[model samples]
Target: MSERQKPVLRVAIVGAGPAGIYAADLLLKAERPFQVSIDLFEQLPAPYGLVRYGVAPDHPRIKGIVNALRDVLDGGNIRFFGNVRFGTDITLDDLKRHYNAVIFTTGAIRDAELDIPGIELLGSFGASQFVSWYDGHPDVPRDWPLDHTSAAVIGNGNVALDVARMLAKHAEDLLPTEVPANVYDRLVASPITDVHIFGRRGPIQVRFTPLELRELGELRDVDIILDDADFGVDESDERSIATSKQLLVINRILTEWRSRETGRASRRIHLHFYSRPAEILGSDRVTGLRVERTAPDGEGGAHGTGEFREFPVDAVYRAVGYFGSPLDGVPFDDRRGVIPNRAGRAIDDEDERVHGVYASGWIKRGPVGLIGATKSDAMETVQALLGDQSEWWSPSEPDTDAIPRMLEARGIRYTTVQGWHRLDAHERALGEAQQRERVKVVPREEMVEISDPPATAQPT
Candidate 1:
């Protein structure tokens, strides 16, 4: 059959984040046998997912990922529907009614739990929450508490470093970035002095990338403190570092910071390796962090040496990892915090494939890897979705206008690609007046108003 004569391959992608967008891009560029039509549904008024709301605003290099996402959305082939949620706003039934298949890429944004004594203390926080606040995520509260003088961050990854850097760096330094006004104010009022990062392994085994480890030292007036005892690596550790370039750079950065002089800077970021958090110390709130000292095991790992000590800090932030939330109708793996999928195709407890249903990104796999990794992950899902064309959904109302009409009748107040452009310009204008790159709009209602104003016709 001719391409136009065949039924269009209508696909609905949930979560317009990097994975979903990349999946859409790949499908559009794929050598398909039939015509395709894609619709990207986003929960937030703005898209780009974590890159927009999970990254540190101060890191413009990482934030530059938005530009690439924007290019794909602006291509005009894939339709974008912002402020349209997946579970409640539009259910799996709703998707099946409009498209031949659906792909879920709702990446994990919630912080993974750090089970320890006193972890529930009032002053303790999750690094993902702090990151969302600093990134001006509309869902989180505008104000973040920063009244403490000293804080402890748990974990050794880039997020742990970003949290420490944002807390330790002066607020004035963030003026050139896209930090929201409320975040800037809260940071400027912070009384933080010392921020300690705790890692459960030796320096060579840390999860930090070279660039993130290096960024810690570049902080203007903040001192990077390191303990020489953490660097006592045996022949096995030395050989591991020598073979892997990632380990080599990370070790080099730590070695450089360890040799640097301290006590002159206004703020300090102490890197404490071989320390596993045993408890958060406080009666009512976070007053200190108790950690157990670990010694290198002969192979390459570290084990608790039964020695414990407490570091005096007013607040604690856990940056261990991110966990996925369960969707309304999707089958989720509670323990793994992801959808049970085999190569991007959703599966049941019996391991039978759930036809026409898909998952990608952190929601498909546990939260791991950088944004760049999602490209290959997304391709796996797109290929799975395209290969299963025989088992596609038979939509009752496949007309493109049916959904918009239904949403309008139900007063859903959904936004469109034009709405995103409007909101983008508004944010830029807000920043242009301040001579900064851009100023993020934080409130959901205000963002919706600016993007899809009530006075104007509904954006379709």
Candidate 2:
């Protein structure tokens, strides 16, 4: 048979995030004449993984990437199955039975804890949880103890800046966007003033983009503080930070901070460098953090001196990184903090290919790159699938027609692209009525209900 006459390759991508979407886009546009049918699964009711749930609400330009993705979703070839979790609703056996190849692009969902003794204490929350709460994640618990005057985020990454900026900004500033009503209300009433972002390394080693770093100065009612000590950098360090234009922009901002007059700042985000969180101090709730000062030893590692200091804080957040969730029938690597994969093929501990299985994005690469990076990552996985097409197992001779059957069998409710558009329309109308940007329907049940047809279905 000619390549054109070859059977359609039914591809199941486990995530609807950027990585999965890019992969689907590549397969849809492949010139190889092999028919590729993609089923994109997302645990959330909405698509655009981190863009929707991890990005700060103020960054509307960043969020606009979702529009570009809508074109792909509307192409009518790829199927977007939202609110369908892989581990809970469906199993690996089920995906293999339905599709020829499965790509797990589910990004890291959990944050790395400091693992300190008082970490389990009340006021100590993970940065992921705080970020999710502010980002209006439907699954995040709403009642975070944010009613504090001072909060400390133990990291110097962009996420740390985001959390600090959120705390420093007024609720009215966020009212224009789509933050959850409850979270918005709580933030407006929050007494949080001083937001200290700590870094074990110096400011030169900070991972925030220049654009985000510069945005800190735009906070009208907020103060941006940086000690000259933090800004002090050697020749080698400057060269290292000069690779990206984003880092250059950050350097420019720091260079100009001394000349700018930032007025009317009751709430301020103080950027502190070379300080590491040694311990979180409190009895039942967080009261402060014990920090140790460190200096760069000319090598990559830091040398901590015996000297230490304490900053009185009400809440503490550790914005280190995120990890993938464990799914049934999938072999996970706790050490690497990802699903074990060999060149995109999901492998057991024995290093043998778990046929018909695959992985992509943070779940595959342990959460490092930006949205654009997913394209190449996904392409790599797709190439691997193309290489080993014959080894895949198909439980059904023909199409298992899993979508409709799975929806019926497990009473799984889902939203189509059109349905999502309708909900989008509804949200826009509501936002217009309220004189605000699209007021998000944050409750998962509400989103699911809108996604559902006339029949009443129980919430998941």
Candidate 3:
């Protein structure tokens, strides 16, 4: 066949998150020589991986990104295959045989390990798991333990703030949000009154954004507490804060909170800086957290000052960071918790590029950047893939229809884009009855059943 008449460039993106969707959008818009066909596969029945399952329900601004992603999927140029597990339903070999190239945009899901004494204690928990539970991820249990009256959150990032805020906020205040019914019920009965957030570094070194930091103080029925001593900024810290507007804004917010007198609120979020968790104190369940005082190391880091103090708490949640999990047949760097890749191209042990295989987003680069950063990351990966079109795998039969046929033959009842629309509408309808935005469906079976109903069922 001639170059002009050759088959369309069939690409399989093994993730339906912002990264994968952005990849598809970039590919469709790229000034390529030939036509392309994109297919996005997701493990869940619904699309928008992190937006639907990772972001806190109260963060409507962050969740608004889903609308743009939805526009890309509704453009009628790409196909969405939901409830399709990458390793189990389809293998790397299956993708290589069917598509010209495959891009893995499966972003990080698990929490980075926190090595400390008593980390395995009964009341100790990973922030990612707790976020998943509160966010209504189908993979997590419907119920979460909210028995702790006072909790300690260990981290300096936005996620730590999210964990702390959720723990301290009144559950009824979240009714207008998209929190699932079961999660709301459990949160309503929570005994949490005080949440202490610990950060090892100084205030300027914290990773939370200015907006997220400001929102922490805006929570209803919650008092934002910060020790005046924790706001001590050296010349170097002031210089660093001056260079970045975001850092300056965050510092200002913290300073303002520190200047305020302690309010009489039902719930409290105590923000502590320069305190490193030496150990989680407990026998079986968490009883307290032993922390060490740390001073600036002259550089941007901190060093222990041989001073320690313990805070009484019922539970401990570590929101250090998120780490990517390894795929069944992919090469992953265990130490870094990401796939070993060179500029979006998957690299072998010897650092050689694996032809027709690529990666993007947190899976490509370790979990660091935000949602906006994933778009540029996907662009780089897609550009690299497009540039290497000459070396792409030339499948004998790159039929787009063949994938759905294969999936049907295997008895995997996958969901399509149209099905997702139905599910979305269903949720909206349920929310309307309650005079709220939307109520998320937490169960995987219900999601699939709503999206892809049985043949005997009547259409809505």
Candidate 4:
């Protein structure tokens, strides 16, 4: 308590995902006058949010990003609180008691609605749910009904391709990655033969990154089937492709895929462009997918051409997009599925900034970007926190130990960064026994037990 010492800028960031982690890192490194103290709160026993539960495990290239995130969490400058639900385990008033400000980084996890008939069928599913299931998310169901012989994936993004790839990929090929034992077993038992990915626009208008698009053509024992009509690009399409390197690469890859023979492979993925979902055809479960053929309107989008086609798909997955859920005590914009915010500073219904409250990542701006974009996105929110000093919460008890004691008093057995290491070691040990890189722990109770072992339990 010296007069010369600067006051600590205590911040509590909800959701220890890439966005929240990035915000903490930037705040710690920011050229500010005062020292920064951060506490990261996560809902899962694990961290990494979407990266841990939303990414396809088969893609190892994305795992490298975790190293950077790990560096931040392990830096010892931030407190890591895992397995703590924000609203139930802790609340806004609870956070206000321990920190000067709070930042919500709870990114989108729900699937954007696709308004079409029969979408509520038993066999139709949102791609986010499937992604969660396969990624070993603690909350989703472990068993997936891979009973379908043919399936349809609706969307033009990388997620659509991921759904198609997972459906058609051989489970034997996934042994090297961290696919959960339960998911691996289910995939090994799937009878899926063909998976069709539908896009409303042509190849040039697709939202897929070139790398994800190229991976489709690389699956072993799986042939990519495409129709010549889907690739018939007009002058405008050609110009659009030429203007963007991404489109050119996608065009080249699709051109190569178009020339390939299909029946030679044991499994197949069909790419259908200029097709919009008219209905998910089924009674209790999906039996088919009816799509309306669309044509370019010279405005970069497509319009229905009164032509329709049906594919005999037993399951349908909509990878339309991810949407954010409303937080318990935050101003939310239901239309956009994000917290009402202006430049990362959370706003109220009157559009006035809510002092001491902020949002970042998909919760602030919808789910649209990749992990790299999250860094810059978080910096904006961090700047808002650093730049503004007015109305910051004057916590009565800013002690770091107080919040943990509160959780303990509430009988919440939350996980810590050290606990994460233990759980991680356990998964790696499991993978080692199986001669793989890693095996994820799926069930919530098991993950919690593995990460935060009971006090009387022997050392792991």
Q: Rate the local accuracy (lDDT) of all candidates.
A: 0.89, 0.81, 0.90, 0.89
Q: Enumerate clash totals for all models, in the order shown.
A: 0, 0, 0, 0
Worst 10 residues of 4 by lDDT: 451-460
Candidate 1, clashing residue pairs? none
- Show pairs that collide, candidate 3: none
For TM-score, candidate 2 versus 4, the one ahead is 4
The digit string of per-residue lDDT tens for model 4 on 176-270 reads 99999899999999999899999998878999999988888889999998889887755598888768988889889988887777788989898
> Candidate 4: which stretches are off by over 4 Å?
1-4, 453-460
Give lDDT for model 2: 0.81
Q: Which stretches of candidate 1 lie over 4 Å from their true place?
A: 1-3, 453-460
Tens digits of per-residue lDDT for model 3 on 3-32? 669558999999998999999999999987
How many pairs in model 1 have backbone atoms within 3 A of each other, for residues 3 or more apart or on separate chains, i.e. clashes?
0
Global Cα RMSD, each model: 1.7, 2.5, 2.0, 1.8
Q: Between candidates 2 and 4, which one is better according to lDDT? A: 4
Q: Tell me the spans in candidate 2 whose CA falls farther than 4 Å from its real position.
A: 1-6, 233-235, 241-245, 259-264, 453-460
Worst 10 residues of 1 by lDDT: 451-460
RMSD of 3: 2.0
